[model samples]
Target: MLYIGLYLVAAGVGGIKGSLPTHGAEQFDESTPQGRIKRSTFFNYFVVCLSAGGLIATTFVVWIEDNKGWKWGFLISTMAMLLSIPVFLLGSGFYRNKIPNGSPFTTISKVLLAAIINSCSGKTTSNAVVNMATSPPSVSTQKSSDTKSKKGQEKTSENESLETQTQSFKFLNRAVNNTPVYTALKCTTKQVEEVKVVLKLFPIFASTIILNCCLAQLSTFSVQQAASMDTNLGSLKIPAASLPVFPIVIIMVVAPIYDHLIIPFAREITKRETGISHLQRIGTGLVLSVLAMAAAALVEVKRKNVAIKHDLVDSTKPLPITFFWIAIQYALLGSADLFTLAGMLEFFFTEAPSSMRSLATSLSWASLAIGYYLSSVIVSIVNEATSRGHHKGWLSGGNLNRYRLERFYWLLCVLGGVNFLNYLFWACRYKYRSTGSKK
Candidate 1:
């Protein structure tokens, strides 16, 4: 227990130090490859570590035995925090002495983070305008010849005017694509490159809702698994209330380690200027989530075997299954924090027109709301269908016991698979953009 506390403290300090760059403390641009990669790497590592740790802590809390296990988790967390004091000091050597007062990403992180887990309707609007402006002209030009004679000369002038109009519209579209609506327009290659980025980011944004839906199931359904599993800590009977500790401890500790170490190391190795884009990280995270669900489903199968051996037909009684299954779920789900939420944070801030940062952050939350609705709807449909049969429905609470839980797991698996495929399709088609003048 003491070792765990120490380890968590050390990791947490490291993570917080690394995350300072994004704490509204300093400003960085995504226009340059170096800048974007650097920001993306740090952000991704931070989120992944945080999520993984939180899950571990959650598992511990749920599985821990005793009346005061929750209090012990807190004690360890506090000590780990105290240990982080030196980490903060060490970080000062790498980060600037003072935090940056303002930047584009500061207020917008919330929106992107929210969008990662919620059904967002507004984020598409900004991209839509940019898309419209960049799309090719619908009208075709007619061929005309200029005459050296008087009549021919007049025709020549008309043709020149029409040519100029077409060019003007083309330039206008390019200009809109390159720069933010709020910024002064200049035609530059760098600006154009930024607009082109918008194209790359489209798929990631499209997947936002699906990711949200999957994540929403984590707390509600996954914890139920822990509750049903038995602990083998001798006479000490553990309750589910203390399971959240493991994930929380993991998050609080791992957050700093990845922030300071893994991110910087990866950036150095990859030679990516901006590190990795938020979209890439988020995509990776979505994949990890799918793996986590798969792990959970496997655990369910294991639990069934244990039940058979014990001759226990009661669904609610704790089975003699190992706790590692819960731990695996926590670890994998926690890792997602690095990619999904972090990517959303950076994406929303950078993609949004500067004025709507608040709105952008809020858009991410909409996915969570939508996910809840979707989960409920799916569960209701399944329950209705399976009522006459022995199958379990969506969101069914423990009545059918293992069978019902198994059914829910299968449902999530199917949903997550379909969602991931759709996300990939859109991700491939989307673009990334920056606010600047084109050369």
Candidate 2:
């Protein structure tokens, strides 16, 4: 029953969270400069609001769970979720509903199939050449050929008039080629371009996963690390789970400063809206994530040394080291999240095809999900390998004091450094589809 309830809740939450960002974005018109800026601002504030909610959870909800009960905490969360529905519906009349025309996947599949067939067949047949040179003359046949030739030329001109196929991925352009066979296949230029946009984003999306894997440490090992530390605050004992409040508070403070102060200053200097480009914002987050892991590793080393000095190696009691050290890494992680998550939301929303905005924005959430899964896999592998011969595993037991967490943090720091380099490679090469005009 517990498993069943968990699965159901996961499915429900996933559906709601996936659609919410796109729904909020659709409220703003993207055709105008004002609308685009508003949309970008919305994404930033959306993250700010999310962090605010997280702050409440880490503090109030955690306190309730610790003092009152878990049931009371769950009840409060359910009430909030229920209340948000009515609040959302109140704005329904103002929202511009973008109706689905048809499944974009069908068009994408057709383009893929047509491209494959065109490549396999080799050399496109020229319809204009066929029509112009094909006959023993009749006045009627001559006139028909002339009309067909004009139509083919007009079609070619139309394609040339719009944005040319990007130099990269020239192969997909076969789907939109003017060849007789490709024309019969009926792939539109817009559809081909949409596929290209997705292709370009793939590398950028994959590079962020390693950063998220580092982040997953916050929810798991970070909490455990805190659990084994002194969590006293002015004679009040704090829960280890509430340590996430550090990052949430950082985001709450940094987000507004970034939006109001940093963005306006950046806009004046760069002469572009949104202050910073989406990729630049994401890259900033990636770099900070590396620093956050490094910070975590250093703190862990200090904590471990203190624990060893006090002879708390096998003891379950909290070490005398201040929990403030953990807060340093948490603060960095939060600031990093503020940059990457908002940038990802805006980037995907702007760059995705109109029909696929929802799906594309969902990739931000999906990356975090993948990172958590990867973290689990890495932990398992690391444990198995390290727990051999005379060596005890880096993350072996319930007692974190016995665990070599500093080594694990250093590993993440190294992984984050490599991932940042990978992100820079893709980000430097990436061309924005919507914000292309912005310097």
In angstroms, the error of model 1 at 56 is 14
Off by over 4 Å in 1: 1-203, 232-237, 389-397, 400-402, 435-439
Q: Estimate each model's TM-score.
A: 0.57, 0.85
Candidate 1, residue 108: lDDT: 33
In angstroms, the error of model 1 at 345 is: 0.6
User: Which candidate should be chosen as best, given lDDT against the real structure?
Assistant: 2
Cα-based lDDT for every prediction: 0.54, 0.81
What is the clash count for each candidate, in the order shown? 83, 0
lDDT of 1 by residue, 166-241 (tens): 2211322333222233233222322233233333444455566665555555566666667667655578765555
User: How well does candidate 1 score on lDDT at residue 283?
Assistant: 77
Candidate 2, residues 34-133: lDDT per residue as tens digits? Answer: 7778887788888888888888887889889889999999899989989998998998888888787876677668778878888888855222222222
The number of clashing residue pairs in model 1 is 83
Error of 2 at 260 (Å): 0.8
